[model samples]
Target: MSLKIEIHSFSYKKGGIPKDNSGNGGGFAFDCRGILNPGRVEEYKTQTGCDIGVQDYLETKTEMPKFLELVKSITSINIENYLDRGFENLQINFGCTGGQHRSVYAAEKTAEFIREKYPQATVFLQHDEQPQLNSSLINDR
Candidate 1:
């Protein structure tokens, strides 16, 4: 069976939490508001989490690394179990104030992590506030 993981980044103020279209009904939703927002800074205001400066600010100035670590740990267990059981879909959502910085970074990092650690799973990444950045990477293992 093929396993597909959907990772979404959304804005709490704009779009709110992303809906799971996987039909599984239950999944993980991570709130990124506690972390320091790079958007608050003048230079990072125009940049999304996809930019190097925003990523650097999130990594160095915020607790995002630790938060992502925890998220990785929790999600890893579920991913492994889902793969073992031959599950088809898993949805994970990350939400921040604007969905451009912290949530986007978190979702991107989590997709990367899942792709690296679970080569058997296909990953679909979406930035709800930035539809142009959406992509799907199918890992045919």
Candidate 2:
């Protein structure tokens, strides 16, 4: 039995909290603004979170690992319960000023973590600003 998790990354300035059609109404939202931004650096300014250097900067310079740990703890509990109850959708959103760096990083990491931690679950990742890397572990709804 596979559970479904929908992870989204967006810019707060461009899109507000994504509307939940999963009957849950709302879901978790994490702001990436507090983390040190690679966007401010000249070399990393044009790069997205997918870049190795940007990912390294976030991992080495910011508290992203600790933050993801907290996220994992919360989502693990919720995902287990959701699976038990046969729930279909769990939405987790990450937001930042530009949605290109910090939020994108967080969302990608979270999706990867969820897929790794819950192999039976289906994870869909959507990046609003960078749709090129957007992917789905399951077919579109």
Candidate 3:
């Protein structure tokens, strides 16, 4: 069986978490507002986490690594169980004030991590604020 991880990044102040058809909550929501924001700096204000400079700043200046580790540990367990139960969909969300900086970075990295760690699963990544970049999918299997 193949598992699918749908990762989303959005602005908390804008719409909060995305709701399902039944109006129930969906997935994990990691608030990245507390993390060091590169957006506050003028140099990185327009830049997204996809930039090397922004990525370096976040990895070095913030506790993002530690946060990601915890995310991985928790999600890994759930993923294993989901796979065992033949579940097809899993959604994880990352949110920040702007949804352009920390949340985007975290969502991207988490999707990458999940894809690499679970080669049998497929990972889908989306940035709500920056739809121009288009969504990406990792077919690990």
Candidate 4:
């Protein structure tokens, strides 16, 4: 059996949390609001996490790296277990104030991490606030 991981970036203020459409009840929801928000800055207000400026701000000025390291550590174990147990679906969510900067960056990085580490799992990435960036990555091992 193949494992399908659904990762979403959303806003706590706007959408609350993303639902687990996979019918698995739900999964991990990591709050990115604690890490410094780039949305508060004027220069980065217009840019989403997909942009370099916001990405830089989250990477350097904030504790996002450490936060993500923890998230990765927690998720990696579950991914391995899911794969081992032949699970069908897993959902991971990242939420921030605006769902633009911190959450987006974290979601993107987490998706990349999963793709690189668990090549056998299929990943569905969605930016709830920025739908244009939505994509599905199918990695068959």
Query: For this target, which candidate reaches the highest lDDT against the unseen true structure?
Result: 4
C-alpha RMSD in Å of predicted model 2 compared with the true structure: 2.5
Candidate 3 lands at a TM-score of 0.90
Which regions of candidate 2 deviate over 4 angstroms?
136-141
**Per-residue lDDT for 72 in model 2?**
84
* lDDT score, candidate 3: 0.83
**Rank by lDDT, descending?**
4, 1, 2, 3
User: Candidate 3 residues 60-125, lDDT tens each?
Assistant: 999999988998999999899989998877888899998888999998899888887887888878
| C-alpha lDDT of all candidate models, in order | 0.90, 0.85, 0.83, 0.91
Q: Model 2 lDDT vs. the true structure?
A: 0.85
Clashing pairs in 4: none
Q: Write the per-residue lDDT of candidate 4 for residues 1-141, one digit (tens) a residue.
A: 789998899999998899888888999999999999998999999899999999999899999999999999999999999999999999999999989899999999999899999888888888999987775534321
Clashing pairs in 3: none
| Full-model lDDT, candidate 1 | 0.90
- Ranking the candidates on TM-score from highest down gives 4, 1, 2, 3
Q: RMSD in angstroms, all models?
A: 2.1, 2.5, 2.4, 2.1
* Deviation (Å) of 72 in candidate 2: 0.8
Which portions of model 3 miss their true places by more than 4 Å?
21-25, 136-141
By TM-score, the better pick of 1 and 3 is 1
Report the poorest 10 consecutive residues by lDDT, candidate 4.
132-141
